[model samples]
Target: MRFRHPDGSIVHLAYCTNVHPAEDLDGVIAQLNGCSSLVRKELDVPVLGVGLWLANTLADRLANSSDALNRLKQALARNNLEVVTLNGFPYAGFHDRVVGKKVYLPDWTESARLDYTLDLVKVLADLLPDDASYGSISTLPLAWRVPWSRTRDAAARDAFNRLENRLAQVEATTGRRIRVAIEPEPGCVLEMIPQAAHWLTPYSGRSLIGLCLDTCHLAVQFEQPVDAFAVLARAGVEVVKSQVSAALQIADPSDPAARELLAEFAEPKFLHQTREYGGPGVDDLDLVGELSGHASWRVHFHVPVHAAPRPPLTSTTDVLDESLRHLVGGAHPLTHHLESETYTWSVLPSAPKNQQELAEGIAGELAWLRGRLVGLGLEEIK
Candidate 1:
């Protein structure tokens, strides 16, 4: 899970644990024992990096009790696992029956979202590796695009001010700096790189606030990876972390069977923001909404990067490859943390039938991404 970039920087690769959603602290511990152990063994490495996802209940426990925190640390050490990053996007109940828009609840305008993220910062500070000087947490972009206003922007600014103060306190006390990376999705207020740049211009040089670039989201919007990276760099926006993920792309959107093929993934679990590639941009609520579109479409659903489900239903792995090349193949690398995040493993149309198969799929993705990095003139260090 450790690699030496051509720039002489050590980058850590991890697979996001949000794929295995847990309800409480005990469930999370179970994952470290069951899933994490399996993945480490599959990789056949002495140590593996895991980007953990802590729900509200588990985070609250770790933040309040030193014993719980120590238990988690011990678990990680026992399983030859380490954590330099976390998926703090989902606050609560991520595995419910229907998590449609509730994932955006308690937006930045509310104090709850700020409190949850602050808690994550505290936990990440404790869980960082010995040689690590910093950690990362990827959060939701401001909020859902609808029901947004200029007044909400002011509220968001206030929240950021509070978070900045807290981050300073953490760094001053622990000497471990943690940055909160706001991840941009399709229908969020800061969907594309331009919108993210416009809102983040004010916090130009602030190290605690930056963007978490997800390749799947960019591909869904039809924005070329190199073009997006150029825009971010030109805007002085730093990418604190990058999620190596792939989205579902349709070759022919006008075909009715293609719509049916995409519909099989439209479960009641999460939001699938579907988009079409006309001369202009096309938007729809979900994949089912784009069934009538005549142009090509891509869905926000994260799929396995190593393989496609079937013909006419391919993945956006090419975009992910290009993004990684731009990020690390330069004279200077963008970020030191790369996490493979395919959280929709269980919800995929032709997903693995069992837990062992799921672990194999995730390990395969991490290996595939590692190979991609190695092919770019980087060396994998055991």
Candidate 2:
């Protein structure tokens, strides 16, 4: 889906395909022909923009072989799907049964991360629509907070500097500009918007690296979206993209049912960083026990943007709304890319029964978000 901003720039609304477990190229192609097509049809849109998630191996293949790239591009065109951005956070093994901390492996402090990002750049440059102004990729926030040293910090900065130069070179070669959005999560080296803005202060001159504000993570940290955006603007940090999402909120952790519900969401699949409403937080749900039970708690679980959980267990869609107001409703557009990134479908307490059900759930989310964007004065391009 595409929306026209008041400034005449096109805002792309896409759903990240990282939710699907398709690492191999064939599986991805099947998805384009199957669920993706269904989603486009369900939305009744002529062109559907997708936030593509390519496995490292698949990215290498596409970047290295023009024939392979053309095949993937043709698959998308055949399915009426378009690409404007890529989710670069999970390198590989995203669908693993236990991907708690491994998702942060090979962080920006290492060369492997740089290699993978460049591959994504090459693939995205060709896949993006000719009318699309730019492409965005969201990555991890440097590395895990712990086990990081000055040397590692220096290395991460150096990696980003090199990434900027390489991105510029790619723009020169492809005539397409692709920017990287450093996604900060709870307990990461750079967690909050203020810290991320401070870290990004030096790169104000570099237009390729910016922040990808995930509403789930932002709400979990209790950062008001209005204030968060103000800080980023003051730091001159570009909001390249926003994962339009919501987080699970426990109104009162003391309630026995809510606590039990937490365990249900505590599967070994992903890390669920839990935070008290306006107090201290825990890095992972494993430490959720440490949080005081006297107040509301928000988990880093990406809930559907449109729906909250059962009664008494609300979602952070309220926070999501605030972010949307600034990102979409403002007179001028601050970010041109918005992605529905609820990748926790299978882990939900009420997980979809089948692929068709999953497609319906995803389409529901996009529809809800589309209505919200339309309400914000964004013209949905049919």
Best TM-score among the predictions, by candidate number: 2
RMSD of each candidate relative to the true structure: 1.6, 1.1
Candidate 1 error regions (>4 Å): 279-292
**Could you give candidate 2's per-residue lDDT for residues 2-89 as a string of tens digits?**
8887778899999999989999888999998998898888888998888999888898899999988888989999999999899999
Measured with C-alpha atoms, the lDDT of residue 335 in candidate 1 is 87
Clashing pairs in 2: 1-49
List the pairs of residues colliding in candidate 1: none
Instruction: Estimate every model's Cα lDDT from 0 to 1.
Output: 0.86, 0.90
Q: In candidate 2, how many Å is residue 346 off?
A: 0.8
TM-score of each: 0.96, 0.98
